[model samples]
Target chain A: MTSGYKDLSITVEFRGGAELLFEKKKNELNLPGDEEWTLRRLLFWIRDNLLKDRPELFLLGDTVRPGILVLVNDEDWELLGQGEYKLKPRDTVLFISTLHGG
Target chain B: MCSVNDAEFETDDELMQPDEVPQTEGAICKKCNENNAEVVLRVKDTYCSTCFLAASTHKFRATIGKSKLVRPTDSILIGHSGKAGSTVLLHLIKAGMSEAVHKRLMYKTTVLYVDDGAVLGQTVDQRKSTISAIREQVHGLGFTGYAVSLNESLHSSEPKIYPLDEEAEDLKGDSDVVDLFNAVSSYTSKEELLHKLRQKLLISVARSLGCCKVFTADGATDLAITILSNIALGRGAQLPLDVGFVDSRELDIKILRPMRDFTRKELIYYLNFHKLETIQTPGLTTKKEPYTSIQKLTEKFVTELNTEFSGTVSAIFRTGEKLSIGNLEASNLIETCALCRAQLDTVFTNTSSLQATEFSKLISAEGPKGNIGKAAFELKKFPCVIDAAENVPLRDSKNCDNCSCSKGKEKFEMSAKNFEKYLCYGCRLIFKDLDKQHSIPDFLQNSVRQRISLDDMREEIADFLL
Candidate 1:
């Protein structure tokens, strides 16, 4: 058997109780870098690698659930082309669930 | 073009595509018409970041200014959660009051953070840290802040100058909090209680701090959800008071929602642009199911619909704005509800309807058992004797305390004797489920007691005049 995949490094952060789905509010993941990572691809990766439980709460239809805002480098994912945006090395992504009440 | 039914089953990718790209790439600002548009808002409005900020600030000022609910000299208490919406509101208020702004506000502003960690089931240490962070945030903004427990509503002191929690003991009431947690009856009641208690605490804090106006940062989307949820909870009559821009239901301290016209998206954008940090405040969802709570379900429904059917939230809010409880005369307005303190509707005072309701309740309670007992069975057998007893008269409108009629055993219990007279229909329904009468909060109980005593005095005076 030959090992072919390398880890892609990126930072993941959660806010507004989204962190409850993960071990901590922030996590650094090393995803397989064999294929280029899009935001959609990264979501699946996070689901497989980091999401602890309640996957439905964090994901819906290969993307973050409705009312959960996704920001890439402090800018809205929608403005930056949403799920199509490519993940780069050392990129910081934040998922904020506005659904949580005060 | 697909029909609405077909569209509901469309793939997420197709749904995400822009339905109508009204603006060309790198469009000019809608307002200034010179700078490159950075954001496209609503259907057509596009603006650069600077223009968007200015437009949002202007809209905020207009929202508050046009309402005429806030006075120039009145002190305002802000119910701040340090979240995106409240942060933007605080920033806008500060900017509007700055020297650079032309129409500078002249009112003093104080921030009040209600620690809801107890409800969220946070540990004491976690709550302490959260409070300190909030205190620092308030201090960093150069404003005085007060931190109080959400449980303060269980037993609040008389409104005083210093509104902060004086005692260091845990704010979570031992039995009350346990009952609230155990009362897992319905998500609506728990949500309703928390909501009513939060409002009570906010109003108390505002009054104590001498703030004439209390401002909450509830945006259009939030208010729309609330309007529907309240309607589902049998509070349609309170639409105006719940969803209106200015709620004067509390006469002395007006509660204002200056951010009513803004959407959550706009507020989040503002927070991001300004590089503002928000604290993550846990809510009932921490330990509760989304579908179980009417509020959570409604919020999810509204927000999800808003994505597929754009402008749904704004449309709902527009409908809510048109609701009014009619022109209440002074005499009518004085008859306030004991719990929510809103003016009573008093439209269902027909004696026939009241008796019908009582009869139905009795039948439902005594259903299955057929426990009419010997006395009720005997009364049923003799209609003439029952009619004669009803006419037996003159002692009072009600039967004697120890009499069988007064203690009908099978009769449904009315909530807290005369207290039911002062409660609105919604509160009365809620109080019916609460098993412990003593668990009623001090504010409501005191008001009820005072009203009963005043009613007693009026009856005595009427007797003397006769």
Candidate 2:
């Protein structure tokens, strides 16, 4: 079985070109799996969604995680208990990258 | 569904001039026009430039004019996307006010731009190139633009304060821009650094220079949120109408979105049809910050709803507006936060678009006077808010020692550490579905590249329309 939290796991991946889709996070950061967002899908979604760029999310081994600091659905999971936070179906997540400008 | 009449047919291959044709992947996507829709050679998920224009303009006008209550003197903040959104914002600004009236409204128009300094892969040089371009845009439009922030700039500044990211580049380019940049980079205390930034950005410049109300081209998706905000906040969020040219009250800014009625897809089409060249986004589009689980979940949820439903998609936002189509928009003016009279009376205002089922629930919900209620009362202040006054402390490039980093601008840098053991795309492919994966299907590996057929075009249109 793919690595997942207690009861939730959705597969996703990363693509790398054009923008800096790749970032080096510290070891032992609070995340599971290593793959980032998939290539074609990530590019397509970026084109499709018209999102503003920011250090939106973290791709720890091709999987998605909550390290990206902006809150979706107006809930700061840090306030909602961080990485252990459970997601109800239908919550919207936005990805703004963190590697915006130094 | 209503039955349609006999549709006209056009066999002419050249219905539109080269200028009229919209290019997206460098293909002839216009063969599916209503006049020529029956024939083959149409593309998928694409629109002929003209059709896209009609749909967006109709949507923008209908939605912005839904209440037709927008007055002339209203000061609006334009969050430009440098694309069709900015075009529409400019067009609407041009259309709504005349030269004489525009002079009156010049101070009323403030453009907010959030350039993410170097993080967006925009080198300081690229960022420098942009100011001139943006200056040209302001000059062309004859309006003032307030640089909001290096969007992701805060919390990431003052490298000397923190050990600099070893990978950070320090090759400073020439231009007074570097000096301003370094001046801001010189601060030691994060709190003080942040305050100095606020002086130039968030609270001081744009929002303070108020008109009557604040407006944005928040187009459809965000428009949906603006409407929802009202439904959630009600008259408690009722912004003041008489905004003098300079007021420090952040909430005093009333935001109106003219293009919230139009979708991005529709807006793009409208801009292309009218021959508007947007600020070009060169390079590949990629996400730097990967999405979190909540973000993915929320996106899927919103997409499913948008795809499945036709109307009422933005219902939560404009519920009352939808319910009272022809009715004058009504905002219940609650006098005070029943709990916090010590604070300014906060409104628990509702929008005109509250759905009937939960309509009464949101507007009249009362809180007990107990401690729990008091805590809940305090919670009301927490919500989606953007400080219209955002700032950036520009300092001179370290290359130019003549700049002022000592005045609060901290020297920033990021050296690439070898911890870059992030996942590559190959590893990610294992988790995704065959369809969702970015790779091409085996079946299409040997397909010939040719003009698309008609049936395929219709399906694409119908699906996008849905």
Model number with the top lDDT: 1
Cand. 1 TM to true fold: 0.81
Model 2 agreement with the true structure over B1-466: per-residue lDDT tens digits: 7564334225454332222212233223253445311111111334444455445555555655565545545566565535456766776566446665322323266666544343334676676566556656655665656554433223222211111112223434323222333333211111122222332233223344544444445455434433433332332222221111122234444445556556543444344345454554422123322132222233334433443342333554354334322212343321211111111222123432323222333334543434555444443442212111111111122213643233321232211110011111211111122222232211111110011112234445676774
Candidate 2 per-residue lDDT, tens place, A1-102, comes to: 444433323322121121233332111112233333223234344333432344233333332332223222332222333333444433333332221110
Residue B120 in candidate 1 has what lDDT? 65
| lDDT by residue (tens digit), candidate 1, B73-123 | 889999988777777888888777889879798889988887767676777
Q: At residue B215, what lDDT does model 1 achieve? A: 91
Candidate 1: C-alpha RMSD after superposition: 6.8
The RMSD (Cα, Å) of candidate 2 is 25.1
Give the chain A TM-score for each candidate.
0.87, 0.33
Q: Model 2, chain A: how large is the TM-score?
A: 0.33
